[model samples]
Target: MRASIESEDRGNSMKEQIKYGDDVLEIELPDDIIVDRVAPASHGGAKACHSLRDDHAEDTYEYLYGKIHQALIHASTRIEKCGKIVIACDDNTRVTPVKQLVPPIIDFADARGIPAEIIIAGGSHRKMTRMEREKKFDKAIMDRVEIMDHEWKEEAVFSNVGTIHAGDESIPLLLNRIACNHDSFLMGIGNIVPHSVAGFSGGYKILLPGLSCEETVRWVHYLISKFPSEAILGIADNPVRRTINSVHQHRKIDLLVNTVLDGSSRVVSLCLGNPITAQAQGASISRRVHGVPVNTPGDIVITDSVPESVDFWVVAKAVTNTKAFTRKGGHLIVFGPCDEGLSPMHGDALKRMGYDAPRNIRSRVKGGDIPREFLLEASHACQVGEVMEHCHLHLVASGLDVDAMASIGLHVITPARASSFVRELIEITRNEVTGRKPRVKIIHRGAEILPLQ
Candidate 1:
């Protein structure tokens, strides 16, 4: 079952509760502070396939594999003869069920006497641990195919694939050597969800940020700072996505198996064909599933980054997604259990750069002030800066210390104190606006939903 908002009202006070990690956070607000509209979570109904549960008999790996095999066969013309195939799978941050997706592709390759391997497209994030691998993959599949993680720092694992000169910026394309050397490359990706950078995540993104070297990933991310407002959730034609598509021309993707997931992370729709076309079709479905139409911007927005937890890095998705629905200079509060801090590698870089606003960060990067090692992390800092530029950000994360949150220009608050702090902020806002009640919007699954205009 999908997690949803549960509300309880008593007298003049209204209490709304949402799942935050393993616990529930109760948000108490005065009736006036609450808005009539509370965005619903995208639980794509009974028509969509549910996750593998005892109640559902058809949600088995055998059924999923049949769908996967048909898609692969229809899209893959030469999978029967391809000597070496590499499967580009998403890292742990994504909810894609790689274990179920990989077996069918491997079976096809094995039948054709082709060798195949799985590469975890980690991008700049740290490598997945043994436990994470076990969680994502089944023992049977793990025993059959070799699985390796992309090492962005290791120079030998990458090869230069020319450069993409987009709008005065020359970004060198250094991709994973294994992916480039394969006779055929197949990408197993989740649907194109609303993303901070690429308009939607999936498609060519599985290559650029997924399997690219640090230089390629950093430069493209830095390019995103140029058009922060345009790079919004639910948009499919943003500058960052255009650049990613341009870079994709350097390498040919044989087939793409993209799945649209419901709120419960079940495979709802599967698209297979040319990577671009399949992803576009999946993105269309994603827009329908996750897009929430807003008649007007909210004065105060409260959201949580659940499921996409473990670090403030992924949790920041809630801020970016909420930014689209917030009024200019309004307060955006995000609460999550960021147990991994900012990020293991990018946290230090974010602190060093400070949240100097997006414009200032852009100028510095343009002038080459950012060090090479920190460029990828700086790109992330730029994203935070861009979000801060549009709204007053308040982050309530227990894993991150006050100093760390402050360093990133976020007002830190504990989960227990979030309601009180927001209540006071709304009261102050209401008084300043001549007793106008604040329009507060609560998003149950902020990271997953796309607030559209």
Candidate 2:
């Protein structure tokens, strides 16, 4: 059920059409390039929130609040007398619907006479604007609770917890001072999905990259890059995740509430309990919903980035997820409308450190060539380099110009020119090889799907 060619469309100019958010991209393949398959979109039994709300009207808040209450009571040793609670939530870039979960959580804490505040886990990303904050939270909740943004660059706001020894090198675990010194309980809220680095999103990730200092974020990403095999899409338990969970031993994160959302961003399943335990349960549901099994690797795989894929930093996930299903020296083309360009915050860093091959970048980093300010940039460059080493990557995006694409080691193409460009490239490659047409595969919402081997 992974991919199938439409028998009726075999004779037509259009080979495939995919949904890219609210837009549709129609791909027309030339005679020389044969499309082997077009994968079906993964459906996770997701339903519209309004329908779910109506169906479970009497049980909605009761079911959700019960779970949240049980998790806090079971996980926290001082829930009865806890004074302050910090809820770490995803920012605008993530697909998580923070508004849905925050209101109920605030109500629960207020009833207990515990003061609760929300911190936007911006990580290395830019801070959310006031308008964005207003849109993300309900008016009632915003008026009562203090909403703060995490500032990764502010040194005074971070406190050193301890150091994690990863071989000879030790990584310091510096967290947001408010989060690290929470008077009572800490809760992390996020949606579980396939992640390129930490196997899956959510769990302590809401703490590490979500709330930790810039140095901690850089070290964690670098660690994941060191082990490519384990740190891949659709994976559940990996070294990167293990390292993040290890922090719980030193710093206590009481309760974690992770949800599995469908294509419409409706919650299909909700997990509550220990951070690692809840995340694992949520990931299990995500794998079944998003995992697509492929019989064999394709010579050329084209993916459409959707949802929040408005920047290269966000949309590059399509490249990471599809890398496993792509053959060596093959092509992986991502088509999207990246209106924000590379990234609002990290674009300059990515441009300065060109996407050299991973091996070369690693050598330079080990040799002390990459400055401290560019460490995170180097990690991103390393990931792009690693993907490029395996496949010839291309991007058909409107926001980034040709030079910007080339600067990051991506071949640029436009929606109008894609057909001819693909045909020409395939024809040349076919002639050099056995003159056999390249086997192509198309994935709709590629960033959201997890291709399983």
Clashing pairs in 2: none
| Candidate 2 residue-wise lDDT, 178-243, digit = tens | 788747578888888788777888888888888888888888877755766424566787777888
Tens digit of lDDT per residue, candidate 1, span 215-258?
A: 78877876666666544456887777788887567886777777
Model 1, residue 86: distance off in Å is 1.4
In terms of TM-score, the best-performing candidate is 1
Per-model TM against the reference: 0.89, 0.87
**Model 2 spans with C-alpha error above 4 angstroms:** 1-9, 19-22, 30-66, 69-77, 229-231, 423-437
